[model samples]
Target: MKRILLRLINFGKKLPLVIKSIKKIYRYGGYTAINIASINYGEILKEKKVLITGGSTGIGLSIAKKSLQVGATVVITGRNDDKLKKAADEIKNPRLKTLKWDISQINQIEEGIKNTKLLLEGDIDILINNAGIVNSITFPNVTEEIWDKIYSINSKGLFFLTQTLCDQWMKEDKVQLKKIINISSQGGFVGATYPYRMTKWDISGLTQGLGIKLAPHGIIVNGVAPGIIATKMQPNYHAQEDNVFCSLNPLKRIAMPTEIAELVVFLMSDAANFIVGQTILCDGGYSIK
Candidate 1:
């Protein structure tokens, strides 16, 4: 009788576990149904066409390299034909192409976009305006020529290039979650010793303004503001002892072009679709300081 009673007790204990298992199965089924209903019937990142300005070197080249790694067909633009060709060769991907044109000239930008379209074979899925110049002059010493040079390249060129791309995308009617990633600088956020900061500030404003205007078209615009990155643009920092410039940042270090490139790649990806109109500070906490 004792053995039978013990067996009954064991059966009773297992009854709750059996009920829990059934409940879990039902919950899983409901989740699966919801997941099925929310499925996206489109490709995520494969075979997308990406265009990047100033892509022959530095941050732009880094972004192109990462984009190509993710199965994207990349077209890079630069003023130097040899540099562009070298960058394309170094990437060593069949999906990579190079175009030579000076972005500072509006006429050159228009012709370059036309040539780029032929190379890309369709509207660009992603456009990265990574070309910019920095004039290391104090306010009092700033020249009109220098100011114009900075504005022409950093502000006017970027604005029109993006406008041309948008016009083409509209004409083609290939509106599949397009993205525009502009490379701004920390100088734009705070006072800097360069007149170029004015141009960068404009870039930040354009990023936000265009994000709103482009949202209805399924396009997102954003900017990445990098601080004290180790690039050709700042060769003086490299020559400094102890790299004291990096110590100014809260992170106490400089950022790599690849690090900034990763953020740009993410901004262009579908993973960051909701991250619009924001200028992400990839400055290793420099802005905080």
Candidate 2:
């Protein structure tokens, strides 16, 4: 009787997660067979030239690794030279290169663009606008300095880089596909704090605006809004709120960096040819909850 009771208890504990998985499969229907973790996208990106800003760590680093795995000539840029160098070393791919870029400095970024164009041999197939910072301040505490610092890197910097790339893509022959992905936050869809939220909202808007403008040229633009991804970049307080944060989403967990990276790789590929002008939320269903 004791053994039987223990078995029942274990089953009961695992039942909810099983049910949720079942529901997810049912909702997505046809996509159930492909295991996201094991699926190999090898060499599909062989001909692509990709650039990812802030690609030294966390989600950006994951993207660089995956893109390199799939055989793309990848360039990763970040403000920290040490981190960028470390990432390149860890990745250890001959096709992967690191660039020192502080996107907040528009003039410097423009110069980097010129060099990057030559590095990629005149055309970059994909650009991932993933560099951003978060500054949390209450309304009473907010200041001009805080706002400027956040926007200079997050919104203003991101926009110019996108513009520079789009201009280059426009000049290229129209036969090949070009993609731009802006990383937004779940805060964009709903109200949250100050400048961080504002920056994300700008990302989504820029994606849509540029999506329309670039669509006619066979260039696709989209945005990704992640919820509480398991990254160091999240606020320090989130560590204490693990259970509380898990409760915010139906998945009952935070998303892994790899999950977001896979989504980015998918978006960058020809697989997402039909997807455009949309900010898809990969927040473990946080928005719905």
Model 2 regions more than 4 Å off: 1-36, 235-245
Across residues 38-114, which tens digit of lDDT does each residue of candidate 1 receive? 22313445778888989998889988888877778888988889988888778788889998877889987778887
User: How high is each candidate's TM-score?
Assistant: 0.80, 0.83
Q: Best-fitting candidate, measured by TM-score?
A: 2
- The TM-score between candidate 1 and the true structure equals 0.80
The predictions' CA RMSDs to the true structure, in order, are 15.4, 7.1
User: Per model, how many backbone clashes are there?
Assistant: 0, 0
The true-versus-predicted C-alpha distance at residue 163 of model 2, in Å, is 1.0
Query: How well does candidate 2 match the true structure in TM-score terms?
Result: 0.83
